[model samples]
Target: MALPVACLFASVPVYAGEEDIYFSDLPMVASVSRLPQRLADAPTAVTVLDRAAIRASGARDLNDVFRLVPGFQTYPNNTDAARVTYHGLSDEDFSPRVQVLVDGRSLHSPLFRNGMNWALVPVALEDIERIEVVRGTNSASYGTNAFLGVINIITVDPSVVRGFSVSANHGNQGVRDYTLRQGGKLGEAGNFRFTYQQRDDDGLKDQFDWKDKFTSRLFDLRADFSLSERDVLEFSAGHVEAVTMRGRLAKSQNVLIGGNNPGWPIHDFSQSSTYLQAGLRHTLSVNSDIYVRYAYVSDWASDRYLNQSANPAYNYDEAGDQGVRHEFEIQHNFVPLDKMRLAWGGSWRNDAVRSDTVFRGMSWVSRDVFRLFGNLEIKPINWFTGNLGLSTEQDSLAGAHTSPRVSANFHITPENTLRIGYSRAYRTGSTVDYRANWWEGSSLNFRGNRDLQAEQMDTWELGYLGDWRGWRMSLDTRLFREKIPNRMIQVQNQVEYMVEVQKIQINGLEYQWKWQPFDTTRIQVSQSFIRIDSEFLDSALAGPLSGLSAVPRTNLDQLGERSAPRYSNSILLMQSLPFGFEFSIAGYWLDKMKWTRNSWQDRYSRGDVRLAYPFRWGPRGGELSYTVQSFEGNHGEFKSYGQPADRVVGRRHWLGLRLDF
Candidate 1:
């Protein structure tokens, strides 16, 4: 691995273009600490995915795009929800350790176990301006759910997108997608944009149960108004409806009858989500500003299904869940002194959930959360920088907690810097993790325990950033160690519920490098190596399972240690071809890993390529492109517990056409 990386950076021609993108020495990030700072001066390491890289990767969804980030892992899902994690300890069907935001609005909600739903995200790829991903814990700034990392998505300004655009995609596996967008001047001092889109595709093939498929339709609108010279107003609204097929058949009638639970029958699971957001910002002076924001989100899913058993008395009904959230916040950023900057904010949120299937007979369960946070940065000298951050949060479900962080950056030279940082973060259990009461037959399938405590994580990291303008190359690297004393996990069998049953220590090294070799050629590469250690607690040894001795401790330890792969790598290249043509290729390789304790997935390597051509006719212009994903043949990335087969991914080909009018 080291030899290949060294050879790539050994020698390159001296070529620069006016449009070449370089790693700047100035503070250039806005999402890490709620303040804009140069990458070298920031408190933590961050990866920026701009529009050009996003387009060049040829990713149709947000989950696939994260593959470019070091230490990040994501897998495709058919009927089930997709999952994404960093330095992972992942759940079977949900990713609850990371926080995600879009335009300052949190996507973490009770709807999907306090995690973002990749399939239900309302915004289209074309509307995204850039994505900034903080590579470590940031609870000191964002509060809970920022346990492992943070992802902030910034959208393009409406003023720059004035016109009508339409696009269509057709491909194998019943893939059909369409999108229409319009942007214009709303009034004398306002701009607005509207979009409608629909995506449809046949899900995984050769499934054990039912033939799976996915469909979704969405509508989004945004408007920005200049109320005054110092005050600006922004409002946005979006809605999405998704339908997916789920469930599996029984292997045999005797096996189903003996277990007292029948096989899952084929069913349609439908979900609908909507959100409204507004914000007002006032510039008090050249170096000071204040913003007030409010948001409301609602999500509902209907997963009704019937279980069939050999005995008629064992039949049962399942699935109907709904949730809503309301939040308000105010923030202020100012230059306090000659060499110091400060930012402070406060927020209040309310979340409510109602489910007959998940919560049994519960009508509605609600929780209120309040948070206060502040960050201060000081640059006492030209070569030294220090940062301090703290956050206090009060939650009705998990009580109150405080998080703090400290960091220092030393500029070794104009083009190189080194950083050291330490921080502690906390993660409260989600609604389902703390309030669920699922029942099946005469047993408690899953029950929430009020005595469960919030999980805590302590992290220490050393980072470096170097840029070589002459070679048009840059590299960013980090070495980190994370310790979680009371790590949480969900137990199986009777009385199944979430509990803190182990201690976890993770050590990892990851880096990303970029180079623009020529005016028309660009390259980006990233790699990660991780090692995890775990120790089981007494609680795990004395679990609530009926047959406690049947489970082995080695299996329990593997659950935490093997959640993340030992090594992973990605490479991408984009080149401009002759005659207005563009060519790009990307490849990914990951080590063998498991999504759950009882599931197993083998190591796999995959490649994707895209080719596009642009043309013009009179006043109209358009682009036609062809994309092939997973070109390396069939492979599996995830497996379900107790299932004999893994989720196999096969090759797919799609063609896309876009027109601007």
Candidate 2:
């Protein structure tokens, strides 16, 4: 395995300032090795979304966060219904292709088709330490659900924070938000931190008006007790409470049609998550170390309809879901021979999910996964290095899969490097696809497919990186082909008022870029193109079925194309100003993409800007900022079956303030 990138950048103390050490530095992890290497020394593409850049972009949520990073696309009808996709295999109502994690905890709901509940994640932008985005397939290193990419959100360590802060913002569409955070040390051996945030917005469209809110309280306690100079033990726990209202579906059939319909009844939902991790590290020798870690996760959520029609015959409903996961990981590093390094690790995870619908009953599922992987690093020349790795995972639903990866870095000159890499990745089938119960003529019937298979991808990347004086720029592009066999979709047998479950396969390509012209300026851009085709397998099917079908296709399916986007890209720019101030601007463009098999295309372009100033008052510190989001005021449209396919929604703007002591 390649040594942590920290070892290489440790000697390069290009910035010598107190704030540089705390606010602008990347975490010391091995994942960033390819970033700092010269453009001529490596052949793989990489993008780094630094903390300062993220803060300057004025992104309000994770959807806005991706606006600054190229190659990733976030689709949010409103604050509550948001989903991200990579390489163009996405649906309006499903989990994304990429995997999202915050401080090593997955943000996906195992019972809801493995999709994310965007509204429940209460991470304040101010508390983010940094975000590491790995584009291209990385299942070999991170495991399943990493078929497209990995987004790792690293938070601020309590020990490094010594004060408190608070912030509030109000904007268009009745948007309002407030956040508070505090951190300090207890004696010399213990450290703790806590944060809470709430957000509510009326949204851009009439029917789309909704509320997105979450309150997350986290506690991290760390104590160092040394039995000897070479041993240490650490423990930590994090908890979060996120609540949101699901927006009204564009499809009328799914909406309440009778009296007292407040346009759309709020779908009250909540997600509570808790995580515990414990680790022990030991140094066997001056150049070797071994560690063991055990982690546990508990997640629960409930979605319920509020304020039903007054008619006694009408029925209101609620659905509750709960899941628990336990993981064990072990890793070791050693120099068994001269000038050669080796690192290896293995992990095991088990997840159990249970769900119940008020009108239906209850269902349960259990899944277990185990993985083992190792990497070796060797230097063939003083400036040439190579890394090779292999991993295998056994999933309860998808059987077993093995992936092999290889990468090389070559230092051609002092200022440039070249990187090349290739890997295979796969995504396990979602539980939502295997087990679900949609309403059937006012009655409920369970729908499931036990034969669902894992989606797989083969990825290859090439890239260059460079650094000189105060200017640094890097570009990474990838060519990939993914085979999503047994891909799930909902098929309706209208003749019998019954729905049949089915699957299909798809294939595509993704490309992205990152650049920095000066220490205070940065820009990023990316695009994805895909081609999807499907075939039906149910014996009840008749003639020929051609193109891909959007999940839960409504009347919209009759108007457009299926499951593919022609192209999508985002551009972002940020620059620091005088007086602890910063300025930022971002623009997003989505090409005309088909909503259903024959629905008309909807295209849109949006932009946002912000101005921020950081200062201190008495013994406290604070930040006053004003943001104008959706400055372009573009009117967008959402298409759905059985609903007017061309309804328009307007844009919005907002401003906010923050304080810390």
Candidate 3:
């Protein structure tokens, strides 16, 4: 690709000097305009991840910190429950199109099939203080899983935390983890923070035929309150519980070669989740603000498997699921003139789901959504900047919709910018995609379609942002195209249902570059280049469908054009090593892809490293670390259907200790 963009500027010059691109030194992104702006005038394309790049990317989860972001994708497995996607339409087991917030609370639930269960993520990565990631299609500022992207996750502000901490991890496949934190001062205008965590693993070792494991636990809390000088209140709560290791193993134990399907063997996939949130914000001057919020969530799961062939119709719990949510919101931000700026909001949500074993005799399959959003931002000259957004949804399961977006940046001089955008999104179909009724004892495999329809997309982009702070470098690029005329495919001619049939198209070019280059080095690089195309919408088959390799459209347009990963890359390097020691390295590469539709994954590579040391026993501060995951040793990013060797991701190794009181 132009020799990796000419070896990344061969050490210099890739546009600089507009006083070295400083908009107060960039980085402000508020999930692409609920109004924090600046990330070169955000109207999409953001990817912050700071907290020192999430502890320099040795990513112990948070879905591997999105593999350092460019068109993200993930698969560290931890025995099922980790899967992230960004430019891909993934689902072998859920990734419902992105949108996973935390501070604003929506974790795409319907009990995880609507996605967002990176092993019950209840935040504890040292309290995360950053991670914006908006990339594209924000469903007009958050609606319907943001239709394709948005992951806010802010955290860390219990009055900027102060207090105790503890941490631990030990690893190598059965990697254990632990954490505890506490912050104080909750009596004079509040401030609080608390956390507890645990994680365990043993997954993907020659991977999948059972005995891959996981365990989890978390509790969390946050508080803030300063309710007077213009109000402020905030609260949070969290929980997560888990156990995983599910299914597979048979074919007379030769691990599947012939057809003697003994697939539901190892069980225990229980899960639990809970959440709460509250907010109030007030400050209606100094350029205004107002806010209100509420949130709640609940989830449960079970896996019920038994039937060592005495076949009572396979004894089903069929992976039970439960779900819940409740939300309310209100917001307002202002400056309505003086070069405009605005943000408006409204929200109401409800969403319930219960399962009589996957909805066969459903009881609570509720849905209700209502939203109204707005965004404005104008800058009228001083080198232009404009943005307009809209959202309006009223979805009682796939019904009303409206999403819009528009952008234009062109700052072309105060540190380089140039953007152009367009958007139109809609996606709503999940209460099992409009009520699934999956039965198995009497055999009705899949069916759900209360006339499901709400999958539309359209995007177009061209962006660039550069800040060279005289070679401390920065860059972000995007060049997209997305179209999804109506895609929602879960086909299976003789049994399954839920169809909207494909159209899909995606074209991409992603970028990210960063460099500190001195003062103890740092660097980052990212790349992507994708292209996908799909088909199968000839009114979705009734025989005259000519191709897609036949039988139920078998390859399904090569599974949506290989499901994203037509080249991918990531790199990170941290440095800072001498006496107080620190080091890092992160790497990834991908090419072969497709995570389902008869799996096919191959070209993947990984590398990770970390080393640290920092100590002081006097005022107590500690750090002592070591990590190595995959270390370029075993690979396979996920693939195991008719297994022919994939799913192995070995190497591992860990040791960490935090302590600070």
Candidate 4:
């Protein structure tokens, strides 16, 4: 079936054109500019994810969402353990290096290793307007969390919608879900929208009787009032709340050693968050306009490890993050000269983070941090564009640092554009690396690196883009080499029952491609190759450092060999059939990679399908749909040193109904 579909796509005749369609016409997942000027002129690799494609693919979470994106990868640690990786290097969590935004507000958590709690992101497949993905470095434009890439999610506007809609679904693995949405206009300038959704299911795997569940509610209100013929005020605010319960796996050996207790120690996690944003825009002249934006985000999470016998004691972990940012932008469309137009802008932001932990009537740890930053952009010609930006920030604990960026774009022809860009990106070291006082179980203390310097990277890229009628394509390849004078790593020795830690720097490259061969089908592919040279390591910790932790112990040579096969790719197909019917299929594949001082090899491939048909009853409409995910029942697995590999267990299926009036 897939072969015939591929043949059909290959047989289609290529369309041709001279006028380049604006980037605004591309479906986006995030709030990018509604015009093509920024996308065409910006000196970065950006890809847009359309809503039609998203609906067709039937992705239920961030993992599935990123499968269609190139150069991005994800690994499931267990039933409850999932993490994203980019540019070949990844932390326990990838949030700090890859910034994610919903409607222009950053979703990164300043308290939790700079990673966003994916379980709390208030995004529903049905509400997505578009997603804008920028690959390579972007710390200069979006601040701290943009080390490797940026994912921006945009939701539908209230003004363009009318009436109410509802949907219900059920599927494999005991899956059940539902969604409710309402949107319409009020009076002359007010528009409002509200959406509610819930999901619950016994996952595909049988390990620990895994159960996945979540609930989300969102509200958006917008008001447009004209103060004068030349000025107008636009006010908007959005609020979202989400909650979920996640399950984790316990090593069988650990369970057996402790006794034949199945309920030994169960790991369960939960998260909740609320986000609010508002913006105003005014036209100063026919050629110029100015706008301001503000946002407030609050998030909380709790993790529990419960002992199942006698009087079960629960070790509780809790944390919260609050952020506020303000931005001012100005645009002028008038040409400075014939064939040349100029646009420029500036932005400022401030972030605050706090966290705490507790176990058996004791305060484990606590910390707080604050950061301030600013940036700018400029365009000199219609066919040629340039940008120069810099930011200086200070952390209460990590001190201060400065970053700079520069980029240029030149139109080779109306049908082809060339781009060259460079940026310096950095990430503040985590508290665990700075202030952990004790090991997981031992009384031995680990001191914090107060003098630790931020990890920084120098990234450069060359890209080309072309568009012709229904055929659109883009290719961007980047080379990144980073230097971390105080890089951090945690090492543990099982043979000698000892532990050692240190830091080192590295370098790498990323390649990406986006091709849409038909109006109903699109294909994206991304690959990354990285090399790390650890110039420092304690030679005395031989066996554990060189044998057990040989992967990291190798320093430069070890880093090089360990960094191969760090790549990911995916393909998606969606078709709108005649008579209100639709069908979609998507496939994703990722290479095995490792994390921590432990040598772990991991990899997996999966596919999903969705079908829907609409029916009408008088003036109302309704639809029935069916979805099957992980149709191949692929299981994720990880191998650790001296220990048997652990498999990530789960699969899912769903059926649903929707109504509109």
Candidate 5:
């Protein structure tokens, strides 16, 4: 902190490109502070991904857009198991540290212990307007589960999506996609838009044991109404249904059910989700406004592993959970003073899950949480500003806790600023961690202790943002440190325990640059480096008790580091060509990443290119494009085995056509 302060006071000049496709914008973001504030004044580090970056990446999946972010990692794997993790806190399947939201609705599945199911996400990439990512802890604004970071996705407004549009894509690796969307003004009223999409793919053919074959269909609708000059209403609904291959194929089985034997077949995971959201905003005065929102979501999944096999149950739904979530929230925004602004909100949520194996002898389990949060921004002088935020949450299982954040910014100039910030965040254990009593063939049983507690961490950051006029570019840099008292990890011996027995510290640095040297050419780069240190607090308690093998984590070493690569960087170059043609290329490189204590992944690099022809005719427009991924040959990004593959990836090609009317 002292050194960074000295550097800030010295006014060290930073060099980088300008904002290319995405620039961390403050005034335009509502997810960071909950109040409208300048990006320069936000309390923490932020990364913004606009629509241009999304389209420029030629990404087949929405998660690919994060490759350009300073500290995000895009692991290439079977679509069902792929991960988009933040700040190096990724270890295995089901990334639960970060919170993901679409239009303020959570995308986590209760049946899976709050893990994000990327396959069933209802929002389509084409409908996204922008993504606001908090690069550090933000539980002070987003609530309890917002531990490491937050990814808030805002979709295109209904009013902006006019007429009708259709698109299709065909490529290698059994890739097939089709989309249809329509938007129009209601009869003398508001606006309504709807979209339908279907995607099918057979994952990497080489890995057959746990093949990644899936097919999914999605549908969503949005309606907006302007009741009067000061009142507005918005309603949205969406549904997704998907079937994915899971586990090994049963060679032979003879199980009797009812009057006949049910033949063993391909073990597949079936998933379906539906959600509805509504919000109303009313203006009370010139500087004050109030908004109320409500959302309902239901998720269902069935897996053979989740069901008890010893009892020979014919029903699979008894294994996994059929869950429902209800959330209601209200917020107020106002300019209380000429130089001060405040945004305050409160919310309540109820979650209910029904499972026979997870909670044996219990029909269902329910939990409730209540949260209150507020953020205040004050600009006393033109060159100095302060932002403060705090949130209090009470959970039925983990009691109550509060998180707070404070930051002070010194404006060397309007285009250059220095910020110093600190925050404290708290995370509650997931339902699976607190209550897990499942049997898998008698020998491998997963049991959960009834006395699991919450975890806490403190973060400190020094950040700088500059827009260099002389160089025709923008640069953003940051240094951060975090310390955690108790981090959660799974302990498996004869039984399983979710324990927090490690004290860990992390130090990191990040840089982002965007340069537009000429109007026809653009170049951008982003890089990040991080280091982690851990100490086992209870070494003796973690060892084996008698004869059974001890917990796998007891032999942990520092090499894992939550499976986050030590460093990662990406570069993008885009150029405009004659005859309505555009050309762009992107390259990504990651340092050696570790997945488990014994498994080490070597460094890998990959690249992609997009070539498109755009044309306009009167009022309608369309584009024809071709994209090639993994253009630089194969490399490994994750440490998964069975069959050796290139880049742990294979070459992919896609041809797409989009038309608008």
Candidate 6:
């Protein structure tokens, strides 16, 4: 647009003086322990999804922007095979207890140990520039699955993305999309950016069936360099190629797929992913600093769920899974004595996985991990502040572990704050729960258990923060309690080497609010209440649960309460009109839930709508939009209990355009 707004002001100034062009009266939150503070002194519970709340939330993937995050829960299915969770321990899909990152690497992959392949998310929400969301569980600063939450993702700084852009989108099932972006400058200290994306869909359709068929293409790049005033550098890379559709989901033993039962052993797999990362920062003074980062990733997938004529000797013939990972990290930050601030780091990771269908042969199959971490923040006076964090981990396949966190903060001014925290976490097993061996030859089999052990948790928290600025408002709150003890579950036909165990507890409250009394209106609200209690502790070595149907009593009793939603709420609104035209709305409320146990899906409320318009020609600028999803029409976000057309979900509309040069 206008040459990226005239190279974003040729040298500087997009937001230098601030007049609240849209939001952010003040904002700074950096994944809790990776430093950068002041979300009322972080330490836990942080959320920020800036960029005018992602352009007023007309979200198109990126998992629908966490449905406006608050105890985040996703799994309403629009497909790219979606899954997301935070406060609700969602199960059976890639989310594996949530921890996601972009700028700080880690996109969690050992081939979907628990989650996050959402069809190869390699960034393209207009290069997302913000999305913090730490919302709890700091396994001592991100080790140990970060236990229940973390979704960092930050982008945009390529000298502020100087120029070129394009975009398009089209509607209804089978939607199509495209994007292209480019940035500039590389002299006088450097800068760079790039993007390319494509999409295809036709996934959730009504009238009984039509399922998850998706396609993707992506490429991303970033570069920055200063290499002077004490060094600075950053680089990133990405690639993705995809195809999707994986049906055969028996709704946990219910068998349904509409129109005279369609979804049969559906297939269509193909996948690819790649990554590269780099980082360097050095500024050894002014309070100290040193940092390093590295990342490498590779992934591949194939499908036809293995059959080579039913295991033609089983060496490999496309079933899926291939992964590689390498990570390295280093850090040092200090202020040894100035009201204190300390950080220490260590990390090393390696994973190699191969699968012929959850582990059979193709070789490669490795795992290694090592970590050490430290965090400290202190004030010791003047309104208090304290924090401590630790992390230690070593694993070849679950062994040594440690995670800890402690905090206290009370500011009561500077807009108010209060907090208390505690944390501990560990969760291991994934790589198909330590090596799955789902032998398909003899009709079926499931086995994996390299003597698994390492699911433990303990958490506690209380928090509050408030900002008024004369009622241009903000408020946040949290209360939590959690407990877990060996929850592994991966069984089929009872249990044995496959896995099963449970013990859970969770109690919670979370609330959020933001308001901008004017300046083209804005409002956001979030709510969550949770309660989950489960017990099965290896039900006598586990039995029962073999293709459910005895309705009214068979998902083995709430079994971890399916896709969560113990209680939830979300509201969003954005407004500005009269000429440049724009408006938005969102509402969601969910409660009743289940995804394959006790088959149910009652509580529901969904609404979404967006409209936009803006134009300019001489210097370029663009916008055009329309979106409607559900909007309270034919809705169903996964229901079960037999013949519900197997998880039906629908309602959609789209139309979009963007341009800038």
Per lDDT, the best of the predicted structures is: 1
Residue pairs with backbone overlap in model 3: 21-415
* lDDT, candidate 4, 1-661, per-residue tens: 1112122222321111101222213221111221234355655767666665566678766556776665666554233335554554553453456788876677775445557656555766776766778776666556556766788776665665678999988876556777787877766766666777776555435433333444445554544555566555555555555544444344465342332233334444555566666666555554445555666665555554443433434333434323233333333222334433333344444444443331212233333333333333344455776656555555565666666777777877655667787778776765545554332222233445565556677766666655443457665555655554433444444411212233434455665565666654455565666555555435434533565544445543343234334555566666667787878777776666555335455677777788888799998898888888777875663444554334444566777899999
> Model 2 over residues 1-661: C-alpha lDDT tens digits?
4444234433322212423422233223334222233223322344555566677667777666875554565655443355666544454344556777765556666645666666555366666766767766666666777667777776665666667777888877677777766777666555666666666665556443233433334333333344466665666666666555554532345453444344245465666777777777777766577778787877777764543333333333333568777888887776666656666788888877776552235456777889987766667576676767677998877689987778887667554556677777677766645555544235454455556556656655655444432344444455544454344344434311112223333344455545566677766666665555554445324411223244433332321124445566777777788777888887777766544333333677878788888787888777778887677775553454344423344566677777776
Best by TM-score: 1
TM-score to true structure, per model? 0.93, 0.81, 0.33, 0.78, 0.89, 0.32
TM-score: the better of candidates 2 and 3: 2
Per-candidate Cα lDDT values, in order, are 0.82, 0.58, 0.78, 0.55, 0.74, 0.74
lDDT: the better of candidates 1 and 3: 1
- Sort order, TM-score high to low: 1, 5, 2, 4, 3, 6
Clashes of each: 4, 39, 1, 17, 9, 8
Better of 2 and 4 by lDDT: 2
With candidate 4 superimposed using the best TM-score fit, by how many Å does residue 307's alpha carbon deviate from the native? 6.9
- What ordering of candidates by lDDT runs from best to worst? 1, 3, 5, 6, 2, 4
- Tens-digit per-residue lDDT, 301-359, candidate 6: 87654333343433332337678899999988766776777778898999888776667
Task: Tell me which residue pairs clash in candidate 5.
Answer: 17-474, 17-514, 18-473, 18-474, 18-514, 26-39, 634-647, 635-647, 636-647
- Writing each residue's lDDT as its tens digit, candidate 5 over 1-661 gives 0112112212311112224333323224667787655567778777777666677787877778889888888664453455677776565355667788998887766676766777677888888877888888889888877788889987877887888989998999888999999998976669998999998877555432335676889999999898888778989999998777655433223222332113223466777899999999887766778889999999987765433334554443322658889999998887777778788999999887777667665666777889999998888898987999999999887789999999998899978999999999997876666776664433335666567767798999999988676666778899999898877666565577676767778889999888778887777799999888877666424552233343444435343365567899998888889997988999988887666454456788889999999878899998899999898866666544333332257787889898999
lDDT of 6 at 115: 58
